[model samples]
Target chain A: MEQPEVAVAAGDTSDPLTGLRAVSSLRVLVESYELRQVEAALRAGMSWQEIADALGVTRQAVHKKYARRIDPTIAVPRRNRT
Target chain B: MSRLTDAVVLSQQIVVTATEEAYRVGHAELELDDLLVALTAVGGPAGDVLRSLGVTVDRARSAVAQVHADRLARAGVPAPPAQPRTLPRTGGGLPWSPRADRVLTAGQWDLRLVDDRRILRDLVREPSGFVAEVLAVLGLDAEGVLTALDAWVPTATAPSGALFSPDPRPWRTVTRRGWVPAAPAEVWSLVTDPARRTAWDPWYSAVEERADGVLAATLVGEAEGAKPVPPGFERQEVVPVAREEGRLVEWELRRPDRPGGAPVQRLAVALTPSGGGTRVDLTVRWLGVGGWRAVVGLLLRPVARLAWGQMLLAKHAGIARALR
Candidate 1:
């Protein structure tokens, strides 16, 4: 299994899709980083409402997304399909 | 090596409590919902996320109850009288369902830190499980939960306890250091000056010198909407109990609520020269509070430490400004 090519060369601006691809990849990285920070904040004993307040979202939205995912008793089984 | 393990085990106490909570909810077997409630109760990354999603302990309990009610209605059976959940001692000390046990065990494998968040991350990936049922109750499905979990990257920094502890204590303690780009003498001068100290001390609103050479200070509690301070916190007095010229200063911070019998906190600040600047070391220790208040104080120690750290950082910034 080969890793997908993501790195954009410094001077390679010839390919129109290259910039878009790089931007898309960067967006994923940023989202991952933000999620990681929220996890860190949670580990640091931050509350969901507190985290939501920081992220400018409703508490329910945050909980709905993360409540089960961050639970210690349940392991989300990996699936092949979305 | 044992000490490290002990620290990790001590931190993992929340898991045990979560397990207990699962049992209390009348669940014959510990499920993911119970675990989620436990995490929310213990307060960590998972708890925070749950709160953000509007899943509080009360809300989770109600949701579980509602699910039970719906099931009973569907079956046309009347609800039985609620009974206390007995800690299941059948499986050694753990009462968790077999699958839950396996997941928890896997979380701790390979020396990985098994926390509520870590366990939940693994559980969310499973399409069909008890967690899925709990998700459905919350108006969420397994697929949606998994998608969100997939997007999340677990990158929480090591526990703040791990930051300063070569050997972590059973209790929480915070140690912080700050460097100011100013001479030790200059920094110390400002630090020792009672008037300037109040300006940067996050907890102190005012500092006045008494006729007996003891400095009496009014201490502020945490900022509004932050962690709630103990009642009568504002009445506390921060009196300088010990001092060493341009080197160290110690204060006996007495809580106002306790008055004559209040616990005294010894806060020591040390200044040392480093690379044409000064490094400040602050140590805060709570003393002589026994019984229940001792437990409360222990819990509040971290909050107190945070306040002190913020004060010192501000003080350092002031010093930087003054020197310029």
Candidate 2:
């Protein structure tokens, strides 16, 4: 797979207008509350490793799924909450 | 260095496992079933997304893999990497046609190798700027196509416009819910009356009237708490649908917000008196094509679907509560 600069965004950011465009569709909407819950978990300081375990995935998998989302400035504590 | 890494090489592609329909409720992937589902979801955009990305795809993905074996092998991926492989065939049982075979050779779209686990493509339709243009970037290994994710894009037409043209983008999906035990007009009385409509609906604010019909004035409620009601998810033109009065009672939605948001509905509800009760036949008239429409459609569809289920169940319950 070729590397695309703007292309790097698909897996992460979707155009704000992309969601704005969906407003016209009947059954479709932007992301759901369930997904927001996923984001909320991240904000609550839950590690992707722990989240993966709860979601039945490997730590690497969870981190891969959400690592891009982690704001580096937040200084997430790596220590396991358990 | 293109900020690209040797580690970014398409390590291997794995065949996606088939799962239940509910499994794919949130995400879009590129498996045979998923691709088929996507083709159905995006309708036109499925092909357009591929063509826009310059990736050659078809209703038959197996053959698509064979023709792209050189590229797949270069990335160290197999056709399916797993079971249930359906190879592609030509008119004479060949792999692919001569012209059909040329989609990948310097096509209009660019497929940039992202990493061992991703493949990115530039798909242009509505041109969502840098954020929305990139489609899936999957990884390939000894297996075939890894997890190919559909853009899960918003479906409203125009960069921004009303969804009133086409069928509801994502929400307001009208399925043929069977009729209940009541007359169409009788049920219409329960559903159409503004006060009564409010009685039965949690989302509908109230019912108003224009020259053509009565409007349900209510905020389309989200599931518990959903963000920005899904596309085509908003409500208006909501009424106890009746093509022929007293015979069928149903409901329809019009976006009036997004381009292509107008619904081409084909559902009619009927009430047949039976055993002292009414039996209703709720049928779908038609649904607009999915695709760019559905990207936004899914968001709205959830609430539309959920609200329908809730409205009906609640409507019945509310009516029952009122009757008692």
Among these predictions, the greatest DockQ belongs to 2
TM-score for candidate 1, please give it: 0.36
**Which 10 residues in a row give candidate 1 chain B its minimum summed lDDT?**
B158-167
Give the DockQ (C-alpha) for candidate 1. 0.01
lDDT score of model 2?
Answer: 0.35
Model 1: runs farther than 4 Å from truth? Answer: A1-82, B1-13, B26-31, B80-94, B111-115, B125-128, B153-324
Task: List per-prediction Cα lDDT, in the order shown.
Answer: 0.53, 0.35
State the lDDT of candidate 2 residue by residue for B1-324, as single tens digits. 121322211111011111111122222112222223222212132333333333432322343223233333333323232222121110001122122123212232333533212222221121332212112222221112212334434231211111122343443433322213233456657654555666645455445665667463545443322235665546566544444445544556554555575655533445554322333333344354666976776667656655454344333433322221
